[model samples]
Target: MKYISTRGSAAALDFEGVTLAGLASDGGLYIPESWPRFSDNEIAEMAGLPYAELAVRIMAPFTAGSLTEEELRGLCHAAYGSFAHDAVTPLVQFDQQHWLLELFHGPTLAFKDVALQLLGRLFENFLSRSDDHLTIVGATSGDTGSAAIDAVAGRERIDIFMLHPEGRVSEVQRRQMTTVLAPNVHNIAIDGSFDDAQAMVKRMFTDPSMATSHGGRFRITAVNSINWARLMAQVVYYFAAALQLGAPQRKIAFSVPTGNFGDVFAGYVAAQMGLPIERLIVATNVNDILHRALSSGDYSAGTVTPTAAPSMDIQVSSNFERLLFDAGGRDGAALAEQMRGFEASKAMQLTNAQREGASALFTSARVTPEEMVKAMRWASDHCGEIIDPHTAIGLYAACSMEIDAAMPIVTLATAHPAKFPDAVSEATGQHPELPARLGNLFEREERFDSLPGTYEAVRDYVAQRATESA
Candidate 1:
């Protein structure tokens, strides 16, 4: 269960250390030294377990040295107990071959809740054992900020500072992050795109001056998928969906509405663990860096364009590096050199090994706005289901991709349609209503800071506000 940086320089660490150190000191993401695999018999044995019990079995290996089995099970139960659905993540059949896995049943009503709820608990559990306090800094295009905030707000030994693009997200998305007035939550609207905000967050992780400025009293961690624990929790639902469709005897294909590439990468991990996966489809909107990178060998990032699916409007996909490192034969030094060139020029060509390795299990689609709308309309008219723009993009890919007709294709429904009401109404002529729990979201008083998109400004604000000790 040891973790190593994608760059070959940092010391190997266990799960607790990697959980706290979001990015390695050498300016690279952390990954397991080697993947943990399961046998087909083992996978079959887990067919009908409850979500929490199945989560313990799937995640226990990764947390071996950090948490005991009982402690892990308790944490999983406490984390998922608040979810609105008994299934946690439910599957709805669209047709004989097409299905939608609804992942917005938790408090924040987005796929991120599936992981962040547990992540917040893990942060508290590990921090309480020692005396350290965490200053969590994260950037989100839409859902991550709200979900992460809801997970950690007012919790002990933690303070969260979240950044999102100002005036770019939908009204519901903006208010979802700003309306939570917990004393430990600080929201910032940065004048930039999600890529700019993400770059600033990464720079802060490596900047020695940020630590010195705070007198080294508090450590900074991340809530983004760059943190391996977030991705680990995500791997469970892939197994859940597959097992429901009779896995091991039947192979399942997943179409993920990917922006950061974290969710689809979880499916890849499931396959690595010997789940019977047919394919992992990476679906994207007009901001299609992932599709371009997979369909061709081009890995260059362009300007991010705002679309109906604001969450998918990201030019740079951070988690793609972990895939490249694995696909490039886990040679940290070689991948490090390649990553540095991409960082300097914002472009790189995929190597033969990387391209061939990824082609074995991954395919991609880039959906236009017209096609996205059409998909939404089709879902409403044909299946009687109104979907958000992001889910529509994924549904489009699932229907159009050339997969075997006998295999079940599950599209990850990443968010609630109510979160993007305007776009859903425009496409389906139906205005989805917010859940009763969030019925009063519009009336809540909003509080947040409008800041210039600079590392110095964000650093000073966090320095002045974060608690020195828990």
Candidate 2:
């Protein structure tokens, strides 16, 4: 599949090029030129497939000639074999109508692991033999940092530097990323929020003179959802959950606790690929820009306030670029205007077509912190489920939405509850237990470089690190 920039200006590229170049030169996410579709019968035939097998089957079309099916399956099998659960993403029947998709069973204990683990393997497979190296820069509110570090740590050809707002993430979340002692791994403690970190990463790409590789053969890529491979890997569980619930025979709905809109947009990609999914529920915390945009058809940004759900405390949802592309009336110039407006005035004018594209397959709700606490307690009482703050918001919204039981409304349980022990403990009166593998996390010494929210500071830091590594 050929990938095109969502801004509609950059030249189109295939799977490998897009995978290697996380964000396009024009500062837009890459999307397939044409979606690869699967028939209802074929989707039906995927029933009873193992998670890894199902992933290879669902993703093969997108990665078609870049990596053969057998190679992809090998990578999938290896990536998932180390997961804590046999079913990489196990579906729990929260209720007859409601199900919680357990996505935290992988190495880093978050939904990102479901994709980044595979992405790490894919990058190794593709880049190892070429004598070229990569420096990965990612911004995380909580989970993505640790997941990326886990996937990229100890790799000789890749150096990953993960940035997070110093005091924003939970202790476990911070520990998860900062405790990694690999030579190729680095954790950046930025004195700002996730938006600041993300902006820095984007600026690193936008700076025309920024060079990651001294030899010029090495390049930069992201393990963030901006990366096509990350999104492609995330699309698997949508199909897996749909197939598990009888997709062609019945439809499904997803209540995704989204941060950057990448996870929920994966559901949209599934819908585009002919998965029989009804409305995709856009679940969010109090910092709910997308929800308000969907309800009013006016896209705008506000000061991102910190909530119990720090991960979703983002104002500029990056993946919305793809939705704007899907909306189609807006071209590069229009999108350029929209983004420039958002950056300056903290809001933008979105056309009815842009809103329609979002509203067609998506409906939204903003769950309060109080509601999240109650939902966590309620789920613990009712279904013996203890979800993280973000996931609890989704469950709360799912319980309230006019959901169809027959359609199997699957909620994406984005992170492990242990990531937010204080919230989980206060809500359920029991500390969410950590996995044994991460048991030593609290005692590990954190190593990170703290920096102010300045593009020059970030550029200098990364440049110095590149020089030392060389």
Candidate 3:
């Protein structure tokens, strides 16, 4: 499958090229040139398949020219083999219509592990075939740093530099990234919000000097959802949840607690692929640019507000561009012009075509702290499940949306409750403990560097430290 940049200038690329080049050279995201659709019989045939097997079936289309079926299956198995659950992404019924898809079953205990585990392997696999090395520079609000670190730590031919907002992340979240002392993992505490860090990361990708500054030794890449491969792996879970609840015949609705917009976009990909999807609900915390964008066509970003759900406290949703490009009829040049206006002014109204296209299958909700807490309490009192603040936001949206009583609505449980113990405890009066595997996380020694949030500083740090590949 070939991929094209949303900005119409970059050369069309295959899956491997898209994976390595996270952001297009034209400063737009890459998307599949054409979506691959499946027949009803094909969808029906996926039932009862194990998670790894199902992943292979669903992802094979995107990786057609990049990886053979056997190689892809082997990578999937190796990636998911260590997950804490057999189902990989297990579904728990919260009520008759409402259910929670637990995605924190992997080593890092967050939804990102579902993709990054395989992404790390893919990087290793592709890099092994050639002599080129990867210098992965990523910006994370909370979970991505730890999950990406866990996935690539100690791996050959790669060095990762992950930036997170200093003093903003929860204690568990901070320690999770800092405690991993792998030689290849370099954690940076940026003295700014996640949006600032994300902007710097994007700038670094395009800065001409970045390529020549590091002795031209290493190629920079991303682990963020900006990478198409990250979103590709995420599409599998939507299919997994739907098929288990009855798909191919009955439509399913999903409420995703979104900050970057990548996860819900994955559901969009699934629907495009002929899965029977009723709706894709985008859930957000107080940083509700996505909610406002969808609700009123006002796609404007405001100041980032730190909330109980730190991960969702992003004002700018990077993956929103892909949706706009698709909704704008895949006219890359037109969308690129539209995006330039937003980048200049931090605001843009969605066009009629874009709004109408998105309105068909997408809806959004902005959950308040009180509502998030109430959902947490409800889940604990009614369903006997302690949920993190992020999941509570999604659960609130899932319950509030108007859907058929028979149609199952699955809320993506994005993180483990223990990752944000204080928030969960405050909301549900139950202090969720870290699983036994991470029981000693608090005692581990932490290591990371604190850096000013500037592209120059980050670029200099990476240039000096990143190792050259032979």
> Number of backbone collisions per candidate, in order?
0, 0, 0
| Worst-scoring 10-residue span by lDDT in model 2 | 209-218
lDDT of 1 by residue, 79-186 (tens): 999899999999999988999999999998899999999999999999998878799999999999999999999998799999999998989989989999998899
Q: Predictions ranked by lDDT, top down?
A: 3, 1, 2
Report clash pairs, candidate 1: none
Candidate 3: regions farther than 4 A off:
467-470
How much lDDT does each candidate structure score?
0.93, 0.86, 0.93
Query: Candidate 2, TM-score vs. the true structure?
Result: 0.97
lDDT tens digits by residue: candidate 2, 1-470:
78888777888887888888899988888888788899888888899999999998889989986888999999999999989999899999988899999999988889999899889988888896587778888999899999999998998788898889989988888888988999999888988889889988987887766763455756778888989899989999998888888888888888999879999989999998999888899988888888887888656777788888889999878887777777656476678667777777877766788877777788999999899888999899998888899999998888889865566888999999988999899889989889888777888888999998887888788867865674
Between prediction 2 and prediction 3, which has the larger lDDT?
3
- Per-prediction CA RMSD (Å): 1.0, 1.4, 1.0
Residue 374's lDDT within candidate 1 is: 97
On TM-score, who's better, 1 or 2?
Answer: 1
Better of 2 and 3 by TM-score: 3
